[model samples]
Target: MTSGPAIYGNFTIDDLVYPNGSTRWGVPGGSAVYAAMGALLWTKVSSIVAPLGADYPITLLDKRIDLSRCRSIPKTMRNWGLYEEDGRRHFISRNESRDWTYFSPALADAASGYQAAAHIAPLPFEATKQLIEELRAGGTKSISLDMDDHDLLGNRSLKKMMELVSTVDLFMPSQQDVLALFPGKGPLEAMHQLRSLVPEVALIAIKCGAGGTIAHLAGSEEYLRIPAVHVEVIDQTGAGDAFCGGVLGSLARQGDLLEALLCGAVSASFCIEGMGFSSLLEATGEAANSRLERLRQRVERAPCK
Candidate 1:
């Protein structure tokens, strides 16, 4: 929020295991990085408010991103990411206890005196709720939350999820999260049910991974499902986080929900084309806008049936 928007999440060292049995070590990975890069594609400034470990590669972040608010911690999160043939991912923490105390810091203290739209990556339910309350209390203009499936499928109840989302302007959950939150239901139906549960959220989007996304505006009968941009898949680690960045960044800058959605899809397209967020971070505004135009042509309103 120093020069522009900010992303709050964790930074991690990722050791990736591919379905083909290939291995990549010492990769920079995290939702915060991917989300910032996604926003940086269209916005001139995107700041990160997260803990940085000594071993993390600071150079991996683009020059446009601001690290002024990032705090130094004993260690950032570290994990091994394993990908399956169906694109399902399994994670194993490198640290015995995961030692994730750095994951949820005092965000309002870290990002003091800032008032801009913010995107929050997945965190524990209580931690996320506290951050949202603090951000709102600090006069943050807008908030977008992307939840973890584990949190949804765990002890966090649907009612608690509803309560948490009501405080934010945007709520984007992956397709897996939606299904788990509403068992025995499809994405669209889950979205509808969620809308009924919390009608105050301005926008609710369900990220369908390679299948694209379906989004609904509060109080509207219509919803739109946009297709993902075709790109050779490399690693899907941070695609969904990148998508949230694009959407929140665009919304904060232009105040256009639909345009935000398109930007998100394009952002995710760039994410999947490389390990971690390398490809996504390499994208420029012109390249992103070009892809947005092409994606705009393919967008169609989904049937409400």
Candidate 2:
């Protein structure tokens, strides 16, 4: 294993329709981009491994992000992010080239030697599983998995989800994903059930958009509720992905999940302050740490009921 982690996901050109009836077109975004930005806030040694194309603007990305592992393709994936007043979002593919959205076996094999930690962003069920397995085989120090709502709602059964969760050191799912896995239950209630359901997972975090994140670590009876840092909400497109990346970044540096959660909260706050990742990209580590210092005052730690 090496010093820094490689984040994997599909690169996309997102056209976002905000709830306030504002529109932004041809925005450079994707899980890997946002996550790498988040991680870079804490550590500069982050690398992104994804499929990029000629259509995507490579210059928009920060120079600190290592792109040598990214696969170069002919066309980038494009999508429309439609948002409603109630914070509901729907993604529609704007590109016919869906096959380039995932890594081929050879690509996955090539990425396996990256060492360090790896964060597999939300991908298809089988593809996510395959990447996790390959990373594990390649001796990654730690692996984190993010859940896709489509994967949970579709053919991926709870049994299969549990199996996948069990294989990773960290399992981060949104509140919606938790509710889907345990219907008619609250996120915290579902979190408790998930911990018991998959005892092998070292950390399980339920990301509640405005309510913040409910995190539980293995062998701990208490749940940590990391509140979201209050900030002007502009475009919240990649907040969750940034949160996961921030967690991994802080964990890599601070070596404490509690501190990592605060880093994530601060990271997400910066992510929503502007359109796309503009605000986050503009933020410096010193600026982020200042926000984290103030946010640390608002953190509430309580025992799981």
lDDT for predicted candidate 1 compared with the true structure? 0.84
What residue runs in model 1 are displaced by over 4 Å at the alpha carbon?
107-111
**Model 2 agreement with the true structure over 114-177: per-residue lDDT tens digits:** 6567888888777778788778777787888887787788876789889988999999888877
Stretches of candidate 2 above 4 Å error? 1-3, 100-112
TM value for model 1: 0.95
Specify the poorest-scoring 10-residue window by lDDT in model 1.
Answer: 96-105
Best by TM-score: 1
lDDT for residue 246 in candidate 2, whole number 0-100: 93
Q: Which 10-residue window of candidate 2 scores lowest in summed lDDT? A: 101-110
lDDT of 2 at 230: 87
RMSD of each: 1.6, 2.0
Per-candidate TM equals 0.95, 0.94
